[model samples]
Target: MPTLSAADVRAALLAGAEIALIDVREEDPYAHGHPLWATNFPLSKLELEAWTRIPRRNTTIAIYGEALGEDLAPRAAAVLAALGYTRVHRLEGGLAGWQAAGGECFIDVNVPSKAFGELVDATRRTPSLSAQEVKQLIDTRADIVIVDARRFDEYRTMSIPTATSVPGAELVLRVRELAPDPATRVIVNCAGRTRSIIGTQSLINAGLPNPVAALRNGTIGWTLAGQTLDHGASRRFPEHVDAERREAARQAARGLARRAGVARIALHDLRTLESDDRTLYRFDVRTPDEYAAGHLPGFASAPGGQLVQETDHHAPVRGARIVLADDDGVRADMSASWLAQMGWDVSVVEPVDARERGERGQPAARAPQPAESPTVSVATLAEWLGVKAAEGDAANGLAEGHASRAGAGARDTRDTRDTRDTQDARAREVAREDVDENAAQRADEARREPLAERSARSDDASADVAVIDVTASANYVQRHIPGAWYAVRAQLRDALTRIPRARRYVLTCGSGQLAAFAAADLRGLVPDGASVYVLDGGTLAWLAAGLPVEDGETRLASPRIDRYRRPYEGTGNAAEAMQAYLDWEFGLVEQLRLDGTHRFEVL
Candidate 1:
């Protein structure tokens, strides 16, 4: 296999070349450590995730994994090659080689965004209030509004008292509504450092009249200072956005976007970009409901706020081009500005008639199906297990019958006739039992219920169901069933032990597909009496049904290690984790010195 030395890759990065440094390891392992800017594309999920993640077949893709045990780079390269990726190469000596070449390794995903946020704070000297000071202000009932610049679900999880949810990208668009008075102080916060800093800076950049500041150290700092967070707070920005204010925000964002080199393209130009050899991701940065109402064809629904906050999840390939679309130009413009600053070649499409565009409810990109894995239904496995159990019972019964008859003597013709009649009667009874067992199995199969029904059932006293949300930790924190517990699907074996014991397990994911697979796995693992079923339509269905959802890493059966939360996320993170995270960010400038592949220019 072709290999690229760490030095060469570093040089390319420094020279602003388009390359994707991909780490083919599971999320847990990837979170442990890797080179800066290395996107995780696990070997187990390569076929399913590669197409969308690395969309350009010829994009410079370098695959790496553990240096010692079970090298996955060669196999991962082969898979990519099979998928029509022409420029695939393995990283020389794996991650160790990068370290050997003086490249710095960092923990957690989305390091680029986090590092950039730090860089922004260091340069801009963004104003901030300590937890104690903010508390004093709140106690005094000062004229201020605490804006949590995280996703609404995260805001709901744990927030400073009285903070309203207005995610990062939305800060510029919605600040006017949340605090119309120029004298009202606006305090923006997130779980920790990045979003809070970025959010406060965004308002400053937009030239909002309010005095903007980030909550220092965010909730983590607040907790260390002995302050309490309000859990399950539902305060949010108003549903309606002011049109005139939105237009003003758009104009301001356009200026910032231009300064960051974000391009404004028409539909025809967007088509040209799409047809090029380079990969292009088109997204409609509107609310989910708005996108569902009407959107351009091939544009995925990526709410602008969440898209900016979780860019790595949306677009893993570092050098890929991204196009943002919105009916109101404000969202796309604001989102594109941040993405451009973070080193993506991003553009905002001109607003066009919604009637001319195709509408879709969900994302258009489909995960690639595994080639050799055949679908196995739960019913089939259940039936197989049932047959095995029946056979074992029959074998034991035959042994007992033989033992009981071992000393029997030969009977007269009349006794033999009676024995024959008894045997016929036993056979009829066994057939009836078989019919009843079959009926029971069919009834159990029919009980597979959707999330809505299960949710309703959960309220009943007689129901013994446990909802297992099998999504990444980050997603689970964003939004999930009020009482759902998080578990990584691939780590279900270990996760199973941590989950609460229940008579039935209802598995769910972002969609129902993974949930179905997880449910099947649960059936094999659980005891015979315990039941497992997939939550048809998953959490999305639960939300569609207007059921309550809770935020935060609530009810974690397994360790939150499934994802490496940013050093700045949540309270009570280890001092080492926080120090190590800051050390990693501080060293990124030097790491960039070695790799030179990053084309970042903080505006």
Candidate 2:
């Protein structure tokens, strides 16, 4: 296989050449450490995810994995080649090689976006209020309007006493309506520092008339400071934008994007980029509902706020061209400013006719399908699970640990305790209705034990059929077939060895697609040649069938390593870890200086 030395890859990154430095290990391993620009594209999900993520077949791609045992680079490279990626190369010596060459290997996911938030804070001196100060202001009924700069779901999960969900990108577009009186102070917050800083800076950049400040350290700091977070906040920004406010916001946003060096390209310019060698991604940065109503052809609905915070997932290949669009004009430019600051070559499409946006709803991903889809109906799977119609009661959402790969915050549990005077560190930040320690710990520990070598337990020790749900770990915790064990698609081969032996094993994902592809891998791993089948339509079908479902980390057949647990994302994350995460954010401006690869020009 062709190989690129760590030095050569580093040079490409320094020169801003379009490249996808891919880590093919499972998320857990990949999250442990990786180069600044490396995108995690696990070997297991390569065929399923590569086309959408990489997009350009001939983009320079470098694949790597575990430094020593069971290297996955060659495996991933071969798969990419099979999937029509023409410029795939193995990283010379893997992650360890990058480390040896003095390449920085940052931990946690979405480092670029987070680090940029820190840089914004450092350079702009973004104003912020401590949790205690914010709490005081709230208790006194201060003239302030708090806006949560996260998805509506996240804001609903846990928010400050009176915060409204404005999200990051909408700060410019919707802040006018939420706090129409210019005298009202506007406080922007997210689960942590990244969105808080970015969201606050966005308003500052657009010159919001009112004084603005971020809720310092966000909810994590709020918890550390012993303040109670309100769970199930329903306040959302009004979607209606009057022509006057929309035009005003469009002018401010266009100016901000221009200052950040984001290009304003016409449809013809986008066409030019598409025909070039560089990989280009065109996205409509608007609300899902609006995107569903009408959007440009071939544009995907990636909410502006989410697309900025999750650039790695949306467009994994660093240095690739990105074009953003919106009918109202504000969302796309607001999103593009941040992407450009993060060193992405980004552009906002010049205003197009509202009539030209003919596409409705999200465009389906053209991922590779499994050769044979051996199917099981959701009703049949529910019967197999012997599920009864009993779901655990949820105050806000279920458990504190939804295994978001430790990414999204709302999926985690809410911390309702008043910790103001308490010194107990054992106090969980998340409300846990039930912690099934045995079930969760057993599956995690037993994964290394080959087969049924240990004493038989009442569960799964002697079952005729085993159902392995391959949904995103967070979704699995939300709802799943009662008796199923949660396993990530990337770790299915190793995961099956730990699960109790059964006559037949059925695999499933959110939709049946992932399960279908994974079933093929399972068929080869079964020692007894057990029949492997997929639940047609996956878990969504199970819910649609009116079948019973359960929630929480009851059965974790695979570890939640697919996503790096953000310090503020889990129930039991240490207070010190949260503090360290803040400290890390504080130091990122310096890290950015040392890296020397970024093109950030904060105005």
Per-model C-alpha lDDT, please?
Answer: 0.69, 0.74
As for model 1, its CA RMSD to the true structure in angstroms is: 17.1
TM-score of predicted structure 1: 0.72
User: What's the lDDT for residue 82 in model 2?
Assistant: 80
- What's the lDDT for residue 1 in model 1? 89
Judging by lDDT against the true structure, name the best candidate.
2
Summarize candidate 2's per-residue lDDT along 1-603 as a digit string, tens digits.
999999888788878888889888877677677887887776656776788778889989998896336777776777788888888898998888888887777777777888878878888999999999999999999999999988776676678898998878888998999888899999988888989999998998898899999999999999899878888667888978878888889999999888888898887667877755788888988876888899988887688888888787788777789999988679999999888888888888888988989888656656775779578876666555444222233211222232221112111111101110111111122323243555434433332232222223455432777889876676677566666898876566778777888877888766666677778778888768678888876765664443445568889988876555667663457889988888877877787777666666677
Displacement of residue 95 (Cα, Å) in model 2 is 0.9
TM-score of 2: 0.83
Error of 1 at 603 (Å): 2.8
Scanning candidate 2 in windows of ten residues, the lowest lDDT window is 412-421
lDDT score, candidate 2, position 564: 58
lDDT per residue (tens digit) for residues 1-603 in model 1: 899999878877666566788987766678888887788776544655677666778888889985226687987888788888898999999998988888888777767777677777877899999999999999999999999987665566679999998877677888899898999999999876888888888889888989999998787778768789998687877877788888889889888888988899888776778744667888888776677878898887677766776677677766678999988677788888888887888999898877856776655445543332223233332222121111233333432232122111011011111122223334434544444554534422332222234446534532355678876565577566656788765456666787767776777665555565456456767656887767655655544332334568778876665444555654457767666665666665565556455566767
What TM-score fits each model?
A: 0.72, 0.83
